[model samples]
Target: MSSVDIPRTYGALLIGALFASILSGAVAVQSLIYQKMYPRDPRSIKLLVFLIWSLDTFHTGLIWGSLWKHFITDYGFSAEIDHIPWTLALSIVFTAVLTFSVHCFFANRIYMLSKRSWILTIPIVLLAVLRLISAAGTTVEMMILQSFSNFRHEVRWLFTLGLALSSGVDILITVSLFYLLQSSRTEGGRFNGVIDSLILYTFETGSITSAATVVSMICWIVAPTNLIFMGLHFVISKLYANSLLVTLNTRKNLRNRNRSVSGSGSPNNNQALILEARRAQGQNSATDSAFHVKSTEV
Candidate 1:
């Protein structure tokens, strides 16, 4: 607008892209570990990991392209600072897609943990879907306007709505999971240790993603003139990817601990332990055997 603030415009972009790439590397490492550690996971789950990783990788590439366009291709052209590159515009769609996938994945987990309760899960899914739609609309408007100032002035509400929905969904998911896990603690606190571990894990994962979304939303609202918000937005998808992988990868250890705690018990005790174990894994299935570890995939 008034002047090309290289620090806030390009420098913020460079820093954000660097962090996003580093996190993408973490995603790749975690994805490979998940594949190696849990080969028995369902086909759909495997496919989901692959899809999220692919999207993350592609999103990283798009970010670099946008950076290149701004700093290299259009260097010294101060007026070009206002124009939104196609790569950046499209990255919004990918971010939305990644967020939507992760949200739905968790929603399905909540459904399973809540004993197939649609009443609790439906609102979350609908909010996530609306978030995705809002992102798509933002992307379309960005492309059509092709100018940061124009987009901000005309359709800023669309982007704002999308961010708000993302935060709402994240907070809702975290609270639902925390409440469910807290309520599932055994009557006598025999397996309180295991349930406590699960509750801690759920709270940590949800908090990480929700905090990132909330911070990004605040940046978007308070400093929309700069690229700081977009920088944080770049990392949100990576957080979601890593959170899911961490959740899946830790299941084996937790299941083993549950087994060790309840080893060689009487038939009734063994059955109770199995139910507790499944519940700790965020699942509820009456038919699950003692040794069978329930998959976290929706």
Candidate 2:
């Protein structure tokens, strides 16, 4: 019999598992900070925040269980896990769900910031739903097939389509959000600085997810039998969860910094101060009208 070399990939999987654990812990801490700081956020926004964290916890638990069963519990012949294990499979579904959740959150942000233009929001909303469907299809395909060779022969296209859709959605959201912010910037460059930070932050998060998905697709196409893609796949969802949480938690610091800059007599300080005051009030402020709109409109 030809050697499958499946055992060789467990080391990579272990590394992935550990990396995911680290990211998950970071996400949890960020979620706590978000709750404490943004308690007055609209109920819809609060629910989204809580839901993302809860899903991240669940995904991490599934990853741990899968790794333990394959690597620690069933050492010998555990290499078969390279094909596809139930937990790993479920992790894929959880990732789809997690990715969809974040994508929807950003999509709604776009709707709000773009002033509720259906033309702008519809594409992302459709793509996100399609992504979830394709991802679910991929998961079901894996479950039914149960072997990498069979997966490769039968439903590899579904897997590729799902990842492609996911990458496309992230790219769209990132580009559109940056464009909207840049276009919405007023004179005096006060908000310009904030926009700059937002553009950078958006790029980092968007590119990471898009790159990981693209890389995974390439690896799957190039070497379907190897676990090379597993390295990226495991932590991909964590990146999504962390991206949103990080954005949410930074509001406090962003507000404080704006206040400090205002006190220093910046020309646009007046406008910044108004926005800062609104955010500080945390009540029914227009701060939510733009990207901060509390509704789940998308």
Strongest candidate by lDDT? 1
Q: Model 1, 101-150: lDDT tens per residue?
A: 99988898788777788987999999999999999999999999999899
| TM-score, per-candidate, Cα-based | 0.89, 0.87
- How far in Å is the alpha carbon of 105 misplaced in model 2? 0.6
Q: Supply candidate 1's per-residue lDDT for 149.
A: 91
Index of the highest-TM-score prediction: 1
Quote the positional error of residue 290 for candidate 1 in Å: 16
Candidate 1 RMSD computed on C-alpha atoms after optimal superposition onto the true structure: 4.7
- Which pairs of residues clash in candidate 2, taking residues 3 or more apart in a chain or in different chains? none
236 Cα displacement, candidate 1 (Å): 0.6
Please write out the lDDT profile of model 2 over residues 5-95, one tens digit for every residue.
5655677678888899999999889888877887677677678878888888998888888788777777776446655777778888899
Listed per model in order, the count of residue pairs whose N, CA or C atoms clash below 3 Å is 0, 0
